[model samples]
Target chain A: MSPAKHPQRPGGRSARVRDAVYTAVGQLMGEGRPDRLTIPMVAQRAEVNPTSVYRRWGDIDTLLEEVSVAALTREGDEPPDTGSISGDLTQWAQIIVDDITRPQRTRYLRAMVSAREAVESCPCWEQRRGQAKDMLARGIERGEVAPTEHQVLDHVIAPLYHHVVFGLPTDRAYAERLVGDVLAMARPADKA
Target chain B: MSPAKHPQRPGGRSARVRDAVYTAVGQLMGEGRPDRLTIPMVAQRAEVNPTSVYRRWGDIDTLLEEVSVAALTREGDEPPDTGSISGDLTQWAQIIVDDITRPQRTRYLRAMVSAREAVESCPCWEQRRGQAKDMLARGIERGEVAPTEHQVLDHVIAPLYHHVVFGLPTDRAYAERLVGDVLAMARPADKA
Candidate 1:
């Protein structure tokens, strides 16, 4: 047999382990405690052996690192460029309503919250998050975004996350409203 | 002594136990399995009876919850508004930078990640998140924002969070650049 027996997914054995652990971690995070997340518990739920789990991730935080990366892969949809920046962003902003209400999104968010509590300095956590930021930055470079696009990104969406992860009433309608309001204020003025 | 002793800091009877257990839990989350977080391990490090630990928080999950909240409180800073949207958002975005870089923010994030793994359908989680959205909506009504704010809120700011909580490399310079870029695009236009 090959060194790794498990079937490969998007990123291969490492990916599968990451995916399984994230799924398991997502489930545990929903429960609200690290105590309930035993190796046997994850192995049983993931359909892998405890030995397999240990051989793969070795520990809960390591496993969670994998899980966090997987969560980053899933988020708001890309907006189709409608020739205008406002139109494109308006469409894009609407995507969060869909992202937040989904079951998996909530699970991913909770896991992130719980992980932030224990390991005060974790590189894995930063690496995965970096991917998403790079993705957004790439989008901005391709458009006419403001000088403070990053702040706009921060102020506008941080609350949505605060709402979503914390069990607040964030939804699609709110995202749409936020986008519209900001767009109105952000519209380029015509020269007098 | 009373049926339950409210643990005091510095040299209280339960203080040592609380500190030890809390530290152990943090270490285990970094070095062990989430489910393997047993009371015995906590008690051993705490030097208090396992029974005492159980009496205080009922189980590991409950203990983690309280600790997670406390840890997050320490990582938080009040958002300062500098009047104009430009100044206000600039300050607001930096807070995210500050929070993400703080060591406690990382630990708090880890715990949230673990908890999300256990319970995907936590009602309480949903409720807390809703309040944040409500705050944004209230901001809109207060005219603290222009009418079409949500789109910018959702599209621009949402991504910053992915960067911050994930420990990505988004910074104030990026925030300033984005803010100007988006605000330039947000100005309302006159109809011919």
Candidate 2:
């Protein structure tokens, strides 16, 4: 019988093992030495057998990818609805900058980037894009002239991530300025 | 005797060893497996003693830093001069996207970022800022309304690097669009 045919119950031994493994991965990533992470090391930290980690995640890259997706896309982490696109984007950008600029978060981000292989899609970026789409949809519903999701990603989100990853100075003011610049790209009707 | 008191000759054995080591580091980085790079591996690749590599560079981080700075700031690598600010920025942005989007270059960039420590400044960023300043200086001399160096960095360079690091879609058209957006921030006199 396929493993998919009998899904493990939540809070069962399987679920607890998965939770412990993910937590151990998070702790290791937090230590800021992604280069040293190995399956044996993670298994030791998680109190699980190395063969189990290998069987479940396949490899370090897949394990990292799963952990990053879980960490970045936390439940209830929706964009703010401040009644206008400008307000929403400014607040969202500030939140992003504030969260990502922390040392631990930066390390996690760098670790994720380092572990990535040459794939066409980035799950973390897709998550951010989905959030951007949610914000844009709200603004459109409110009769506000909204920038495209690509504009938000390119102008605001991309710049913020660029500054963080490259060790450039970033703060709420920088985030607000990016939001303002992208908002300026909206039609003249919005300006009027 | 202080090492600073006796600087190595430019074309001496020291310089030759340094060149060989740097080339080895670049080759290993291009191989796209930074996590496996070590002083011993680099020494083997460079045909130098591991003790010599450690004595010269101290550690992997320092060696990677020096090599990245050297590779990124190669001689005669300047932003294109297109006479007009818009043309110059558009061309420069496109060039940056083209160069950084290559698989090898992307791997090298990720390696550099992963190897970095929490420092106040980034040498590679400073190098790019210098190039941006040069482009702005030429635009000013040509009586073109020019954006500040920071503006160019935030709007154009940051976005390009962001896309590269995150595996997002980027091309010449995207680069040109960013150039246009930043150029739009110039004074109305130029717009007129």
**What is each candidate's DockQ, to 2 decimals?**
0.17, 0.51
Candidate 1 residue spans exceeding 4 A from truth: A2-96, A108-167, A189-192, B1-44, B48-65, B75-96, B117-161, B175-192
Which ranges of candidate 2 are over 4 A from the true structure?
A: A1-5, A49-56, A187-192, B1-5, B36-59, B141-143, B185-192
Best by DockQ: 2
Fnat scores for every prediction: 0.23, 0.59
- In the range B1-192, model 1's lDDT, one tens digit per residue, is 233356654577676667777777767655544533567787776667788888888876667766655554443434344545556555655665565455545544444444543333433233323433444455556665432344334444554545555455567776665555445544545653
Candidate 1: tens digits of C-alpha lDDT, residues A54-165: 7766776566766655554455324345655555555555565566557666665555444443444555334423433444455567765432343335444555665576
**lDDT of model 2 at residue A74?**
69
What CAPRI class is candidate 2?
medium
Against the true structure, candidate 2 reaches a TM-score of 0.85
Docking class of 1: incorrect
Chain B structural similarity (TM-score) per candidate: 0.55, 0.86
